[model samples]
Target: MFSNLSMGALGLTADLPTAIDLAAKHGFGGVDPDLGYLSGLGGTSAVSEFASSVSEKGLRWGMAGLPINVTAPGTEFAQQLAELPAKLEVLNAAGVTAVGTWVRPMHDELPYRRNWALHASRLSLIAELLADSGIRLGLEYIGPKTFWSTERFPFIHSLGEALELIVEVGAPNIGLILDSYHWYTAGESADDLEGLSDADIVSADINDARDDRERDEQQDLDRRLPGATGVIDLDGFMSALRAAGYDGPVKVEPFMKSLAEQPVDDVLADVSARLAKAIG
Candidate 1:
């Protein structure tokens, strides 16, 4: 397992090279490159340079965000899909092996079942696209009941439900980007993950919650750093992942605004230390 720091919570808004340097300096094995930065640098040639820089710092490219929306309308979605092949080529060149995204409900007017089917169909096609590029697609499910209540139609909000959707999608390259905050809010325990295999989990996000707040009341922006709060059992969560054979990077994704208040280097150091202790 390794640590990743591309999430907005870390407040590290430096350029890609600076971010990778900070990640290595702070003892993280890898860093997720900002896709926008990558694009600004130019295409395949720039990606090659970025990969070389990462290797020089003894770090690996962990993950990158997808630029296109696969669930958009027919023509828009097709255009997005068309753009994916080139993106995959860039990722492959950069040595990034995973693409991460959340499964959000897009149409408020649609029924839940209809939305689910639509998601499955689109994700299945996406899985195929990633498969061709030899990259895995890490799909995240938003697990907060509050989030569901705010949505027009309910969607997959638990690991079990996400896993079922992955099965329905029927793509070997499709898997969950499990988040501890989501897991806790979903009211799921470590034991609930016992049946999952390593392949079922493409990546993971590790963050704690405020003990004083109720699970449903805790918002995404209110998360605490891993092991900094006692609400989520970090040790148990790691143990469960180990038991399930997950060996991917476990990223810190706390959305605390306080992190942004601190110096970026200080925040990175603190988060890295906390994650090391939690994963140990």
Candidate 2:
């Protein structure tokens, strides 16, 4: 496992201090910052200050999630290309190691194989752009309304398909970002987790899945906390990670009202405890 497992930005209200505090308290080695939250802290100028805070707290530098649409057509494409260099500079200033993003062609617009290729080629460009900065690019398998290269069709999803594409790009700076919820939503079994390579494992998220049926919002399987009564075979999943040789950083990623409402410390304490039991 990554000696530096970190919390996503939901913990700190984007406050570097709270993030620093919680991470230190919980033995977390780093944090995966949501850039939107970071902007709310003090905008781009705060990067240096934030980096200093992290260093003081003794946290390894992690990624600042970047917002870019690599597959957008026309001038929008130019916009992403133009803005990325500046964004990368900001991330580098913050001592970030990876740049994670979401990109998938609209399902109706591109054939799966072709979309996969184009996306891969574009990632190669991003890899080249960040080559000297030591920042890498990662693509997450998105939920509905986005295009994806998945093993289960019509049910479409998975970073599994992107693995080969990253190899084709052949840049050390490109890889995949993944979450258990997405893998479950795509109907991927624990067996699917066996194929990851460390170079391809830049980002990781944790969540649980239950029935999709609309409930009093209490049973909304799509956004439950880990250990919440659900059916995400985490033991099997972790086994697959070990099988895949992915001893990388992991993040506790509960994304619902209950978990999100709790104080950061309380939430993380719960996550850290559950993760201990889950991983064991």
Candidate 3:
């Protein structure tokens, strides 16, 4: 997989043009441009220019955040769903091949079965739209036990459950955003990843958990740079991706306050170094 820069995930506030420039400057092969921002640029001419600029910089579009809000109720969800095609059309012109969003692992009202159905129904529709544009959609499962355990109903918190949801959706464009942090928190092994083919993964995230927290107690937002403390098995994780022949974007998503607070260039350089060190 290639190194991709995700500005929001890295806690940077760079706009699309600046992000593209920074990504290339920082040695990232790809950049996750904001879909909403891209949409705002308007029309075919603007999008073509932007795409050309990225290509000229030797960078490609990585997975963007899925613009549709899957959890909004009835009419709201319908409105977002209806507007997706237009947004996707813009993304298509920009040469974006993939988009992804996370699945909330728990629900206060809906139980497992109902929640699963809701997600499947909504995601299936979204996936169909993405499929029409030759784009893939990746669904990320939150794995930290602490995030889901205290809720009234736990939904998908593991790779197995995520696969089940994908199966239910049964859309060819549906895949996974395989993440090192979640894989570790869910107590999954490299063997689990062995079962997946490259196409099964749309994108990936590489990060480390805090050493002080037990696996089950780790918070979702609290993370370290890959290999920072050797608390996560990053080597094994990268090995699995290589073995699976995953050639998609593999981004660093270390949600660390210190890193976020640093200058944009410092954050980019640090992540580039850590990612190279972890995956090399």
Candidate 4:
């Protein structure tokens, strides 16, 4: 497995070029570039230029934002689907292997089963679109119980449930973008990871949580850097991924506001050291 850094997680508002440069300088082997930034650049030439810059810094491109929205219905959704081919072409040229999006309960007004079916149908279509490009779609399960309570339809919040949804989608390119924070909140054990095949996972995020809060009580913004706290068993998490044959990038996605307030270099160095120790 390799270490990757996400600019959003770091709370660094740097543009793509600066983010890539920081990622390489701070010991990250890969980076999850901002999709918004990439979109703003526009066209295949811009993507190629970004790819060249990443290569020049010796950094690999990890996952990027999803190129299309699969769940939205109607003309807006149709437009997103229509634009997918060109967007994917740019990503393919840039050597991006996967793209990811979060799956949460957005339609609380609908019954859970109905909403799930709708999401499944849409995702299957997306998976089909991405499969032709040899790109995988990574779906992140939102695990917090509070997140579910606020949703119109309580969505799948567990890794097991997410896997079930992926199976129902029945696409070869669809997989989980496993996050340690969600794993902990969902009450999943290391054994859960061991039960999965490498193909079931497209990528992963590594971060710890505050020990002061209860598991279900932990908020998204309450994250700590990996190894900064003992609320999550990160070493065992990595071991389980290895056991399951996952050799992909594991990104540090600590959402701590405090870390974001610190110097970028200091935060990056600290994160690198912590990740190395945990991965070791």
Candidate 5:
């Protein structure tokens, strides 16, 4: 596992050039690709030029957020799906091989079975689209009970459930975006991750839960930087990744309120140090 700089996840703001500079300066091995920044450059040629610059700095590309929103209405989803090919072209030119999107753990109207099929169908289409560009798609499972409780029906909120959906999608490129926050909240152990190989995971996020709350009581956004207070079992998490031979980027996704209030440079330096400590 290698440390990755995910600017938005850390609540830091910078242009692509500046983000790359910060990533290199902070000792990150990878930086999450800013899809908006790449798209703004207008074409594959411009994106390739920018990608070369990042490559020269010795930073590998971390997973990019999937541009299509799976939870959107059917028409909107179709439109986004239609536009996916062009967006993927830019990512391919930039050498980004992985992208991810989260699944809402509940739905207002759809029951569990219906919701599962809906997600499987949508994600299958996306996985196929990504595979055409030689990219892998990571599907994130939202594990906090607080999130799923808000709706009428609970969907996939655990690693096993997410794997089931991935199988339903039935595409080779479909995989997991294994997150420590979710892994902890879902009552999973390091043993639960032992079954997965490197190919089973496309990317990962490392964060800590607040000590004040029990596992199920945790909220998705109420997280600390990795190693903060040692509230979460990060060592076991990293050990499992190693056991699985996972060589992908591991980015911090701490949605701490205090972290969001700090200066970008301070947040970057602090997050970088925290990640190094946690992973080591």
Candidate 6:
């Protein structure tokens, strides 16, 4: 498995290549450039340069960030769907093998009660676009504010629902972005991660949670680190991955405010240590 870093760690201070270098130097094998990073590099030319730069650093360029709203209905549906081609083109130009979106099932739909149909439709459309460009699309399961099962944000309550969406979309280029925080926040047990493979897991996010669905702001502060500081079952999750034959990156995507103020070396060291314990 590779050690990966999401550009969200650096916020707005660093540039694309700088992030990649940081990750590589810190022993991360891959880098996921946030959408803002791509936007800053301009268009096609920038994407090509980014791909080249990441490869030069011996890091796999993974596309991270959510830009498409798969839960939209009707006109807004067409709007997000229309944007897929350009997004896929951006990934293609950037040499990004996979595109990850965190808000696919969370927002972007109208009166979205029938979330199943909304998600499946958009996934199919976007999957086709990404397939044309040989880029895989990943659906990241995360919460917007409240945890899953309580609200209709981020992702749904059922792991089966997310899995079914992927199966129904039925594209080899389409897959799941499994996340530890989302798993706990959504109330899914570690046993739920059975039967998956490296191919099914296109991307993954790691963050731990310590509390229940209390207040939105409070939950945000508690979720960070790995399975160590939270109520999450990390050992069981690692066992599940082994059962499913997954060998991929364990991306540190904690949104905790504490890590934001820490120095890059210290922050990376902490995250790297947690990843080592989890993935070792």
Which candidate has the top score in TM-score? Answer: 3
How high is the lDDT of residue 45 in model 4?
A: 86
lDDT leaderboard ranking: 5, 3, 4, 1, 6, 2
Where model 5 places Cα greater than 4 Å from the true spot, the runs are: none
Highest-scoring model, lDDT:
5
Report the error of model 1 at residue 24, Å.
Answer: 1.3
Ranking according to TM-score, highest score first: 3, 5, 1, 4, 6, 2
Put down candidate 5 lDDT per residue, 8-67, tens digits, no spaces: 887766787888999999899899998889989978899999999998888999999999
Give the TM-score (vs. native) of candidate 6: 0.82
Between which residue pairs do clashes occur in model 3?
A: none
- Model 6 ranges off by over 4 Å: 9-13, 39-46, 103-113, 143-145, 149-155, 211-221
Question: Candidate 2 — which residues are off by over 4 angstroms?
Answer: 2-12, 34-49, 143-156, 211-221
Candidate 6, pairs of clashing residues: 71-109, 72-109
Per residue, candidate 6 scores C-alpha lDDT tens digits across 11-58 of: 425666787778888877787766556766788897887688778888
RMSD in angstroms between candidate 4 and the native structure over all alpha carbons: 1.7
- Cand. 1 Cα-lDDT: 0.81
lDDT tens digits by residue: candidate 3, 1-280 = 6888898887778788898889889898889978777778768679878899889999988898888778888999999999989888898889889999999999999999999999999998899889999999999999999898878999899999999999989998899999999999999989999878888999999999999999998999999888888888888999999898888888988887777577889889988877777557
Q: Using alpha carbons, what is the TM-score of model 4?
A: 0.94
Global lDDT of model 6: 0.68
For 35-73, candidate 1 gives per-residue lDDT tens digits of 666666677887788789888988877778766675688
Query: How many residue pairs clash in all the candidates, one count each?
Result: 0, 0, 0, 2, 0, 2
Point out the worst 10-residue segment of candidate 2 by lDDT.
213-222
- Report the Cα lDDT for residue 218, model 5: 89
Q: Please identify model 1 stretches exceeding 4 Å from their true place.
A: 40-46, 105-107
lDDT of each: 0.81, 0.64, 0.89, 0.82, 0.89, 0.68
